[model samples]
Target: MNELLLDLNEQQRAAVEYIDGPMVVFAGAGTGKTRVITYRIVYLLNLGVDPYNILAVTFTNKAAQEMKDRLVKLFPHKAENVWVTTFHSLCAKILYTEAKNFGLERNFVIYDENDSIKLIKECMKEVSVEPLNFSAYDIYELICRAKDNLIDPESYKINTMVSHQYYREIVAEIYSKYQKKLLENNALDFGDLIMKTVEFFKNEQFADIKNKYAQRFKYIHVDEYQDVNYSQVVLLKILSSVHHNVCVVGDDDQTIYSWRGSNMNYLLNFKKEFSTKDIEVKEFKITQNYRSKKTILDISNILISHNKHRVKKVLFSNIEGEFKNDVKIKQCEDEYDEAEFVAKEILKLQQIEKFYNSTVAVLYRTNAQSRVFEEVFSEYKIPYKIVGSVAFYDRKEIKDIIAYLRVVVNPQDTVSLKRIINVPPRGIGETTILYLETLAKENKTSLWEQIVKIDDTELSLKVKNSVWKFLSLYDLLKKYKDTMYPSEFIKFLIEKTNYIKMIEENNN
Candidate 1:
């Protein structure tokens, strides 16, 4: 216990040792927020608290893994007992475990952003709406707002101005149909994880589910509390209503996810809301800065002071290193000039002080700005990485495999069917797909359904044979879908279909 407190400042120590009803620690940047949270978990464990009863939530998988890693260093055997995970992942676990209550199957698939968009497009097609009149992205944002606010499809109300009533009606129709499609497919988009979990807890019929979760989690910790949306907030409330031993660490000034329904009011009004419940809510401000120099902290403090709504706290740093002028402001004529100036500075740093190219960074407001910098860096032969962009999972090969799996799981998913139908140079072509689509629409069935009944159609012998072959492959996939693991299914799909060989042949 002493070792845990050795490196913590006084305020951090108080935050870790506070064993009470409710607490909020306003952890500023570079103020040892992660350290305080880990130590607090250790402190709770040291008090003979059951590790399984403790839940620590973070906004990202990386943060959760870091906390789990730190705990493993202290108690390797008990690290797995505590639940440390991102909000969406935890909600997914809850939804999967409690699938019976929600009528979801045990092996429901989780769709990502692309899958959601495709589903929306299909919804629009079903409604006979054009993408020009209503974009998929705009409808997606509308649905996202509704989900974040825990609004049901029947209760989805459009608050648009009178001038846009027609558009609003279109969006509402698409949203309703989109939800029905998801249910038919036995799939849940990322937002549904939180939204459905909140629904389960709020429904009186599932009061037992709420009580079970609330009883299981005696102590709850939320990192990045400012970034939680309405559904996440409700879920947290249900889980902590029993014990009320909830500790949240966040800085109101750092709430930057407002675009995605991150309500800053949740953090700002936490104390006021809890105090009304006759609960003792203690507040701690860990303002000691141990990461940056005093100069940087001074500038940051001045910048953040402009925010009107926040808890005022003093930030101090005792770092030794100092620069003559740490903050630099430059005005460039245009983006190209800005890129050239950055490249020149990088060269100068390497020439004068031997700073490595990897050590320097050029921050930009938009991902498109990286193009100009990449051109300039290439002109000067400076290697750089465009960070924060799609690094994985968006690759063509990965998407192909994921589409295959989606089709395997949900045969009615016309979007995934279209994406992989002609992929890997299958004999199926656009003309054949168009014919199949016409038949399906006339029969009021899915494209896959029409393909299975290809013999009843007037399709040419070649098209009919190709459709039969495709159907045979999917038949084999369906046969093994339940028996084999996803990994084994992927391997079987790749090997049996010669997808890897096709890629190699194309490359050579």
Candidate 2:
């Protein structure tokens, strides 16, 4: 027996060894899911499978890195060859390789949320649309939902027309113009990474590239399978159609991303997907609850059993100690009282109950609920850390600076161009931006291209000077990019754009 199989239980070992057509591991919370996944990869290596033949896909870059680290520890030399990455990253690799086939430049940029919203707002400005009935955020959500379902703009417009006619007209127009802008600027949003790849694979032009990928990766393993959307499922199915050695590990009870269009239906009916191709599926359930005691498992099992739609499985505790502590339930008069009670109980657990080694986690339904608990914890001087909510990159000034950097990196990025065009309240206002947008559309070129040849005779002196100043500043930065280091370029931008002075004036 291999050393990797030593620590796994019967079901886990079975999953690691099952190398058939298709398999599903109904991994419950606290089960060693990553262990089974990594062990399976090792099992394939032990069987003399080429390391490059295996591909592991997870939900986040961090998880992918962790999986790579584990694999490197087990197989130091061969681990580097295995392809491990998030779905978006996988699609990005595929797209980057075949970008020229789709008329997109190899240097195409990826627009983040702020860049995407800024582009959408600029598009709205061109059409004289007000925010009374249609907001940029609302339109953004609609576009995301459409892409998640692999719905093209034309089909989305048709569907919207059949359902909501008024929004149909507006959204369809906006979606068409938005997609045109993205293509014109040679950029893609986060959703486009998946959506575009799916479209490319379905086209006959992608035959050679798809065949190369499908043949290269003989084994495919997807973690967090329950949160896959329509576009992601299609990509996986296409890639694995060649060799049906696909293994998906997930639990239906953990499907909480439906708000983002992630459907658990795909996970629940996963086997049915390959039935037409006659791929046999072996299902394994890991029910051993390693993290909780019998009392907690019993309470959880009862609570989840009431749900009508789910895979039938029991989480049985495997702990050695007899944990017969009754689950505590407390009632509070208000939110403040609840916070105080939770804070006191946490202190008692740490000090009096000798649970010093046990780290406590306070769960909240929403981010706003953290404020009351923070106040209570501060009153008691309790040391606590909030996990995963605040993102430093989401700050306003930070995004503004990133927008400037994106424009410097890729001059064709009109999304970034529009974002910082008048960010510090330069003389270029909405009317001036609309004029530039109309001129670019009429001339069939990028905003930067049109700005270089601006007809300042038609503009008022203030607006004309502002537009020229904006263009000159960008050109100066381009020249500086050749000699100045990144830090020096940032300082130059602050001084040239007067960004700091504007902030100070506003503050005073």
Q: What tens-digit string does per-residue lDDT give for candidate 2 at 4-48?
A: 788789989999999978888889898878888888998898888
lDDT of 2 at 62: 92
Per-residue lDDT of 71-176 in model 1, one digit per residue for the tens? 8897677766899999899999999899987777876778788888988998899899988878898788888887888776656645532137777777778888
What clash pairs does model 2 have?
Answer: none
Report how far residue 457 has shifted in candidate 2, in Å.
5.5
Output the worst ten-in-a-row residue range by lDDT, candidate 1: 154-163
| RMSD in order of candidates | 2.5, 3.6
For each candidate in the order shown, give its overall lDDT on alpha carbons.
Answer: 0.84, 0.85
- Candidate 2 regions exceeding 4 Å error are 126-128, 160-162, 320-323, 344-360, 375-389, 421-435, 438-444, 454-508
Off by over 4 Å in 1: 158-163, 379-383, 434-447, 478-489
